[model samples]
Target chain A: MTGIPQEQNDLAYDVFAKACPSRGTLEHVTGRWGGLTLGALHQGSLRFNELRRRVDGVSEKMLSQTLHALERDGLVHREAQPTNPPRVDYELTPLGRRVTERLLALIQCVEGSMDDVLASRAAYDAGQRS
Target chain B: MTGIPQEQNDLAYDVFAKACPSRGTLEHVTGRWGGLTLGALHQGSLRFNELRRRVDGVSEKMLSQTLHALERDGLVHREAQPTNPPRVDYELTPLGRRVTERLLALIQCVEGSMDDVLASRAAYDAGQRS
Candidate 1:
């Protein structure tokens, strides 16, 4: 098609016409630590330490920052209980659950096709060297 | 379900088991300027200056950096035609096209659901204050 179909064009414009909400969501959801945190929370509610454990390479500072962003955005619900050690738990809010489901699907799609992408990279690198 | 279905778990593990190629692709696709560049190129091949115009808010330095990453990863084919004005056209390789199609889909999905996300954010902020 020479241009996006009118309906699709309208949809795209509707997205771009606003003050750019996607930029913020994209920042929160796709941040370096954000994806891994969401992936870990997808399984169940987690304490701060539990999240740290589940997402392998994230440092304490990054994980805390990511959790705060997600929390502020309303995707994650954090509850603190008065206890000896100050127990806290994090779980997806309804909105969080919906977004996480979509995120997981995207992650799966990427992971599934990664082999082809790697092969493409190898070929591209080889061509560049020769 | 208590856990991801065994098959899905295998798939997830398969993805996490590797040296994490998704990390690189994720970096390229979701880089600050990368998504916009891909979206602009999706319409058709264009010269360097043309791309700058189509994707609003990108700077020359960021655009050049993004193009190089995509080029290295084989998602973009940069054809430099030896001519007086130095005509260079950037287009998607077969791999690029495949990936771009998926990226566009993701962008559309995010755009479609942005309103809900905004509403959620407002509610979240209100809750925090009270």
Candidate 2:
């Protein structure tokens, strides 16, 4: 078929030209801690400590930042209980679930082919050395 | 059904516990400039200058760094010709193509649902204001 029709082209341009808010969404979702947080939350609703445990190396400050960004973006729902200990739980919204599912699929793809990627790196390094 | 069986659990733990090389690969492919570079290379082979143009807002140093990382990972092949100005072209290897295709799919998904993300952010901000 031919290229995208004129109206479709205009619509596509609008996304890039208008500095669409999705750019912010992307920055939030793909930020350093954001990816790991979403990945961890995909398993289930997690309390602060649980999320901190799962995302191995993330510092408390970074984790808090990431959660705030995701919360602001409406991808994550944070609920605080007025209990003795003041417990808080984080879970995915419907939109968050959709995004996390996609993120999980991408992670799985990466995990599945990680062996090939390693081998490729080794060979590339060998070639460079010679 | 119950949770993953013992063997599966052990296998899953192996991925994270070993400090796998995939960590570096992830860093390379997902770096600031790396994502955009891979997305552009998915289209076809591009000269250095051509790539520089497509990835908007990328500085020369960042682009160079990204290309080097991809090349080192064997996800990009750089062919430098013996010519007056030292003509060079960048293209994805078979491995690179596979990775780029996946990246492109992710980008399309992000682009496709951008409107919902924007609306979500707006609603979230309104809630914060009230």
- In candidate 1 chain B, where is summed lDDT lowest over 10 consecutive residues? B9-18
Q: Candidate 1, which CAPRI tier?
A: acceptable
Most accurate candidate by DockQ: 2
lDDT of candidate 1 over A1-130, digit per residue (tens) = 2244646643643322224767667657766678678878999999999888777777899888898888877778899989988999999877677667766665665665565666677887888899
The local distance difference test score of each candidate is 0.72, 0.71
lDDT of 1 by residue, B31-115 (tens): 6577678777888899999988776777899889899889877678899999998899998777677666766665665665565
Best by lDDT: 1
User: TM-scores across all candidates?
Assistant: 0.78, 0.83
lDDT of 2 by residue, A71-98 (tens): 8777899999899889999999887887
On the 0 to 100 scale, the lDDT of residue A50 in model 2 is 91
Q: DockQ of all candidates, in order? A: 0.29, 0.30
Model 1: CA > 4 A from native: A1-19, B1-19, B127-130
Candidate 2 docking quality: incorrect, acceptable, medium or high: acceptable
**Model 2 TM:** 0.83
